[model samples]
Target: MDKNLLGNNVIAQIGILVHDIEKTSQVYAEFFGMMKPEWSLTDAVDKAKTEYKSEPTEARAKLAFFDMGSLQLELIEPDEHPSTWREHLNEHGEGPHHIAFFIKGMEEKVKLLELNGMALTQKGEYTGGRYAYMDTFKELKVMVELLENDN
Candidate 1:
């Protein structure tokens, strides 16, 4: 069993995936008084088209991160057609996309998810950071991310 998944992990962040960033930024800034600082715009984005042929149109997402206290609030916007965010938006129109939790023993947790039943959707390295994806779709409908420690 994956004892590494102990719940000391805080709700480190919440991500919102959208279609327009500049507009949404204003909305959030006004509502939450969220400060948009320099060096907050993330240039690291990797995209791949979904394999669902039955799904309508082709879409992709661009990611940007914002700091809220010690945690980050990542905003993602689709670049074209109708991607995951678009599908979510079309079905429900822009809301909380995912909840990121910080945890210890990332690699062990990922391995345990694999052992239990979760499927790994993607894995990659970006901007000198290491990350992995585990699908929790059928039940949770969220991707569980295993992020390498910054230290």
Candidate 2:
């Protein structure tokens, strides 16, 4: 396809699905000998404007982050509501979820991926940015997340 659809190939983060954030975060922290970061709930539907498979959804998730130099490790605990995270957890049972890249022009990036056969799965807003998950598992073996910070 087009060269550098993502503009840059640097991976900003790696996300993991977990059934229990508290227990999982503790395990990661102890294993890595790092302080466990506090986990927080994602924004509500209204604020997050979450959508699943192109439909609006109330799905939310608890998230914990650990900074690992150039890459951040994220752990996600999805609610019962349907979402990319929840689906992956239910189907795959808690493991790697997505590999994320920080990008500008989210709309264009999403469109490029969509044009290339990677359909958008889920998207939502956060405190300072927004995120979109792309259905890239079949080809890439993992979902792809686009992170756009409003800076």
Candidate 3:
């Protein structure tokens, strides 16, 4: 039980799965008295290099972000592809998906989590960095997202 496996222990974001990004984003924005954030689609499969269960996948999702001070709230509407988001949405319906932590050393962090019995579920590259989704639901009751930025 090495708590140090996850350095800093700060949650950078919370991702929520949704059926409709447009409607959900508007509701959230109105509730907070802010403009609805623009939603964007994830990078194409070739660019993102997304994988699911260790197999290359063409899964992509629409994403919107709300900056909540130190933490970010992400809304995701996944296409009908075999992705973590889509799976969660189909199985559990629209709700919380993952809690993300901004981390360094992507490979090492992923290895550490895998060694600890948290299997890597999905991964992909974004514009400036990459992200990994770990199946930590059995232990943590929620999926864990590891984000490594190339800053």
Query: Candidate 2: where is the Cα deviation over 4 Å?
Result: none
- For candidate 1, write residues 2-82 as lDDT tens digits: 554535666666778776777777677677776643223323233322332233234445666677787787777755554
Cα displacement (Å) at residue 73, model 3: 0.4
Work out how many backbone clashes candidate 2 has.
0
Residue 72, candidate 3: C-alpha displacement in angstroms: 0.5
Clashing pairs in 3: none
For lDDT, candidate 1 versus 3, the one ahead is 3
Q: What would the per-residue lDDT of candidate 3 be over residues 1-151, giving only the tens digit for each residue?
A: 6687878689999999999999999999999998899999999899999999999998999999999999999999999989999999999998899999999999999999999999999999999999999999999989999999999
For each of the candidates, the C-alpha root-mean-square deviation to the true structure, in angstroms, is 5.1, 0.7, 0.7
The segments of candidate 3 whose C-alpha lies over 4 angstroms from its true place after superposition are none
What TM-score would candidate 3 get against the native? 0.98
Error of 3 at 121 (Å): 0.3
What is candidate 1's CA lDDT for residue 148? Answer: 61
Reference-based lDDT, each prediction: 0.59, 0.96, 0.94
Worst 10 residues of 2 by lDDT: 1-10
Could you tell me how far off, in angstroms, the CA of residue 83 lies in candidate 1 after the best superposition? 7.2
